[model samples]
Target chain A: MQNDTPELPIFPLILSHAMRPLPLWPLSAGLSRLAGHILHRHPGINNRIDYYQDHVFLLDITDLPLFLTLEPRKARLRAFRRSAVVPGHDAGISGPLAAFLAMLHGQEDGDTLFFSGALAIDGDTAAVLALRNALDDAELDLAAELAELLPPIAGLLRAGLPGMQHLTGLCLQRGSAASERAW
Target chain B: MELVCPAGTPAALRAAVDAGAHSVYCGFADATNARNFPGLNFSRAELEAAIDHAHARGAKVLVAINTFPTAGEEAIWHAALADAARLGADAIILADPGLLAHAAERHPGLRLHLSVQAAAANPDAINLYARHFGIRRVVLPRVLSVEEIAAINREIDIETEVFVFGGLCVMAEGRCALSSYATGQSPNMNGVCSPPDHVAYTSEGDDTVARLGGFAIHRTPRGAPAPYPTLCKGCFVSGERQGHVFEDAVSLDASRLIPALARAGVSALKIEGRQRSRAYVAQIVSAFRAVTDALAAGREPPALALARLAEGQAATTGAYAKRWR
Candidate 1:
């Protein structure tokens, strides 16, 4: 059976590689702001991950030359170059950006991604599980969340999301009927 | 035969129903059921909607209040029973004897099924529940062989439901306390086994080590697929032996034995994965539905390649054939 699952687009990889020469400080600051915004919007996410408040989570986007460290206690999300000697973290989840997005959009199962070797978890499995569970409950939409944060781009983002989703075969929204049918 | 499916959320319930499930089982988002995990299960309102959706599709909804209640928290279980009956659940699956008694006495009109958590393996135990609590069905533990199941069915009067696919419990259901020994939470009491709060995976050299409550369960080579750190399916050093001393990291796949199970007088085939995603529920339920339909039509059951959905991409018949023994 020809696997109909869409392959990760090269556009993101190209963009990620282009950003490799950029400074990490601005990205870290932006991510921190976004994290704060998400927390403010979804207070339940904070409460869900409260058990891992003392722990640090590393989100490794394998396709991108970037690594993100999330500190729930501090409400901080810092970014680092993939090659950087990042400080120790309690747990780490590494996967392609699409896998992460698919999970966040409720398109794919977290355990399925892990089982299929599309994602890998190390360090603290419990902490990773807590984060995953929290996110699952949150039902995040990166595009919508970003649009809400930056209203000027809201219309463009909302209009472009479907096109991007179709091109990438990524479910960018929660309860996507197309993704459900594709399954 | 009935096709019983698991639904952790309202979406999963709908998916199971749309995929041709004869019945779907779910639990409230609490410790009242064995699959009490974070971000899983339905709220009361969700359960109500789910029941309506399933019923609208000519399917039944079985609510699972299968966990054993705490010493002083009997009221919670009782409330769950009352609420399930009020929500018009086709049946309430129960594991505790006291709770079963309460349901039988208080909700006389409601149908009751013995949870696999009750570990009612023998005819006497099953018949005792049927005779005492008026349970119409019993979800048998995954520890019995097909021959043993047939023998038990010949002696027992109530309908029998057996797990057809998904995660396998190495220990007898309702009795395993390895999770409690490691994490202080058990499926029987807390409705979770190898509770996620205590499970961790860390990289050691070129290998990934999965642990439950700091107890090393399995270590796999880096980049290789690793199973969940379920205590029973763990690797341990027992004396000089250094391997999975208890059971391998494999999920149960009894699809091949549907005919035998039917011939053995099984009433229903249950799929074990409320914690799984709706996509998984739909795929699995549809596959089993096809198999059951084939059996009913007197056609050969189609070869189903479901290993991709199985744990660690491996499947076993478990104790169904007594081959492991």
Candidate 2:
């Protein structure tokens, strides 16, 4: 069978390399500030945060090698990049970049990923449940927020966002066809 | 015949009970049950409350610990049964023979309902379970026709339950390894089939494709609804027929056959969506309750007002009719 491996563009590879050396603290601080403002808009979330008092969550995007420690106890939520001292988090959820994004945006159900072994969670499950419930109730639009953060790439991101699903579908179709032909 | 409804959470259990379900079935929040999805099932505290609530309202609560146990981990399934008995479950639904034997020996007073996951299609298998483990009820596999079911009923003294509505599994229950082949996790061991984490949907050009474990299972035009890519109900190439080879992305809607099923000596009718929301649970349970009520009244069953609730906007009687065979 002819090799049908979908070649990934070099951009993400370059970006991933460049992101490794860059200081993530500033970005994490900025995002946490934004989360504070957003949390105030959803009182239900503010109340749910109290249930997770002092509980910190490590959200690891395993595919991208990036991690964020989320503190959800205070009036405003805070996101911090992983540091050596951030070892004993109350809970940690790790998944592929796409599955995490899909779950965050409510496009995909969390149970689907967990059931499919796409996502892994460790530590306090109750803390994870509280955070999931709060986020679901708030319905935060991360895409819109990212667009606001990067105005020049806003249109490009919006265009690329819709294509993610299509691209995923295309890759699978091509891959399956290749495997079947090989058989 | 009784109406057995599914409940994912305590709220859904209440909704099912309020909607007139004669019995509400649910499972613990772990891999012990088939619908072991996130944010579903009941914690111990919640199950106690739910059972209390259902019992007070004249509805029985059946605890489903139906998934087959993994090798070297039979104790987990046993512990679940012990907890169910301690919690006053009206009956325990089970699929594993070893677990059934343990339940029979350990908790003799607890009622046993053989899970559909057991795939007990014929009278011999059904009777074996009834006789050896004292299983009082058996949920028949979906592969059998009504006539086959009637024949089985004539031969087996145990009560039988049948799925009347909700999602359809093309493969025989307890016998499907497709999900495991694709995702390394299966309904039998992990209690999840077509797990969402392994599913990916992407758009390419003007079409959207649904993939499971890197295999394309379905493709739809942009703006068209893409069904969940369960392996059996997927579009595939077979010779020259490149369409749904096994079954379409339609749900089981046997609401029209309640009378026939009742006549076939089916002891209960089951609705099959524990992953659904409380509103969905209430609506479906209420609709099925109406059908059973109409049959009891000696009147024609009401028209099914549940097309909107079915998967992919379509429903079929599945293998219940001979032509589907």
Candidate 3:
């Protein structure tokens, strides 16, 4: 069988490296806005993660030189440079960006990723589980969400998503698309 | 033999059916089911669609209202039973005696399969349930050996189902209160165990500690693959014994014992993990389907490398071989 180990693409690594010295405030603001838009679009996500309203989660994208802390109650997401002092978090989920995206798009199973050592969770297992389940139920399509955010790029995004997914082995949509892929 | 697969959501139900599950079992979104985790399980309308989807493909849909009903909340369980019957479920897997009596009396036409949570391991208990509630099948708990199961099957009149894969409960089902003691919720009462909300992990120097209800369960080195902090599988210290005390953090995989279980007159093989993803459901269902189909055709069952799906990336036969003594 082929190696199912997730590998980070060189493009993201290069981009991450280039952004290592840049200020993260603008990126943090954009991420917070995107999170707000998601919450606005899918109100039920709030209820699903209600137990974690006060909890803070650190999302560490291992392949990228970025760290994100999400505060669900405030609908805020803060981005930090990899070299910056790590912010305190109640729970943490560390993984490659592809694995995170794959999980987000329902392209991979969270437990399967964890068992395969593609993902490492620390601090609060329950909180992370709740967030994963909430996202799974929401079935958030990041491509679509972004397209909706910028209608001018909607068609371009919709057309490019499949190719991007193919190139990256990332799941950009929800449904049984992952079932067709080899384990 | 039948292949019963778990479906935590409607998508997973379809995945299981599409992957060739003979029957798919799911639960209502409420606490009526054992896998009542946040954002998991099916709504009533979803179940309706899921049942239609399964039935169209020649697969049966089993609804699990297995959790014991709270004293004042029996009506909720009753309503779930009513909805499941109204939704054309193939059968309802239940555990509570009162709930079983309610189902048998009110929905007599709805086939009833005893849940593993009932822990009906012996002939007398299975016979009693069969006699009292007219149950058609009994899902034996994970604590029985193949010889013990075969022996029980000899004296029982009803069909028997045994867990073939997925999570293994170290204690007798329905009787354990460890999770409730730690987290104030349990599979029997609240349809959850060591609920995620009560669990937390912390980085203490080079070790990451997993705690349940504030009691540390596991402390693994940084970057090591850590298991979920289920109380039964946790590490403990008992007089200089600083290791897993109750059970190892391993999932049950009886794929190699399909032939023996078939010989034991087991009517069905059940896979656990309703909280799993559709990807998991599809993969596991197809693997088991291949095994059972091969067994039926007298062909050698293919070896399945499913360790990546097992808890702690390890598998065990549990009490099936009575090796844990």
Candidate 4:
């Protein structure tokens, strides 16, 4: 009676199925909305970059197959996913997830990241500098903002999204063990 | 032991109180507090509200007007202490000897605690502060071992408070002029250490370099975390060695030594992060509350879950144990 539970399914298959319908475009769109909402709440950020209204910057997350293009629109900054049809960005910044996350959350120093070469910027250095100054002026917490955006799952993702990763890892390990038993 | 917590803002003060802080310490939005960081600290109205909030929860508020008085600006420090009294602070923490004397005379009824910035390491200094200015407690500098602390407690009549967690200053509390040498901002005077205005960072090939006052303090490889531009925690080159010369970028975490500190006759446990956010204050205060509550219940303290939040992802017992020396 105690051992009547069903075995866990394979994590890779479940993840694949879950992510298959939701491609990078939609995911990027959702992220852009979230970023826009956060940026909109802090008007000081926009004021810092008011001079760079014409510049569009692309943030390329090297670890993840995603990029966000940020530009000023209608007196407020808006972020959108990069696509073939989209106009070329004034500057393109590339770095690992940590660097981008740190910069986004106002946790890491952009100057330090660029100086140490942890992040790379191409096309327009002045645009990137403006972006950095604006970000520094806005000390936004990405995790907190994400939590606010999704109140129901706020507690589940404290200190960033590591909880989801841990849960996925646990599911994967259990699935692998079940696979071994079947063999 | 009483758990004294730091609150740089009104929100942080409420967080600390809600998290079971026995007492919450804060400073005005001026140079009176040691953590004189930009966008930090409270206004007079904020402190009044904070005090009311803490008092409603059975927690106390201690105002720290602990910065050293400048040559001609003695009136400001005196006014800070007087205002602390006028604001009905449970206690006022002071560092400068002249300020302490002024507070003792001007506000005779106000409780006075010696700030760690005073660096009263020996019993002689502690006794003098207690005798001359009626200091109720002395926040011992983060330089002594548990045994040394116990020895000092045995001789001094005043209560002893020791920093149990948060940032570690390698230099003796009040004596350090490192920040002044590098950035011309005095920690003891300006209430700022490694002021953010002078800090800068740059990317060099595959590493991230953190600069304070145009000097490279830390340069971490790509993807690795770069240390905050702290002068003392900077990587240096000397005699073919290139590493954190003065001290590693580690936060003080003496949670494991709560019992030892209690045994050493420590009256209170101080956490050193007034410049931190409300979320950080809440988490740390609640965690330390559990530890102190466990100690009171005669149970083992919980495993430390705070290492992840520490600077450089590392925590140490600091000078509490013999290992530091």
Instruction: TM-score each candidate.
Output: 0.86, 0.68, 0.89, 0.71
Local accuracy of candidate 4 as per-residue lDDT tens digits, B165-248: 888876777566778878877778765566655666556898766677778887776556445467887889979989877887
Q: CA lDDT of each candidate? A: 0.82, 0.72, 0.82, 0.71
Clashes of each: 2, 8, 1, 16
Worst 10 residues of 3 chain B by lDDT: B185-194
- Tell me the lDDT of model 4 at B214: 79
The segments of candidate 4 whose C-alpha lies over 4 angstroms from its true place after superposition are: A1-183, B323-325
Please say which candidate is ahead in lDDT: 1 or 2. 1
The DockQ of predicted model 2 stands at: 0.03
lDDT of 2 by residue, B194-292 (tens): 674566655578866777778888877654444546888889999988988877777789999889999999999999888655556667888989899
Candidate whose lDDT is highest: 3
Clashing pairs in 1: A125-B200, A125-B201
Worst 10 residues of 4 chain B by lDDT: B220-229
User: lDDT-based ranking, best first?
Assistant: 3, 1, 2, 4
lDDT tens per residue, model 3, B1-325: 8999988766677778878999999988787887777767777887888888888889999999998888898999999999999999999999999999998899889999999888888999999999999999999989989999999999999999999898888788856688878877666766556677787767799977888898899987765666667888898998987888888888899999989999999999999988887778888999999999999899999999887777777788888885764
| Residue-by-residue lDDT tens digits, candidate 4, A20-87 | 44555566567667767777776655554555656788777554433557775433233333333443
Q: After superposition, how far is residue B42 of candidate 3 from its true place, in Å?
A: 2.2
Worst 10-residue lDDT window for candidate 2 chain B reads B220-229
Interface RMSD of each: 5.6, 15.3, 5.5, 16.2
lDDT of 3 by residue, A26-97 (tens): 888888988989988876567667677679999998877889999987889998877788889988998888
> Which of candidates 2 and 4 reaches a greater TM-score?
4
What CAPRI grade goes to candidate 1?
A: acceptable
The list of candidate 2 runs beyond 4 A from truth reads: A1-183
Instruction: Indicate the fraction of true inter-chain contacts that candidate 1 also forms.
Output: 0.33
Clashing pairs in 3: A123-B201
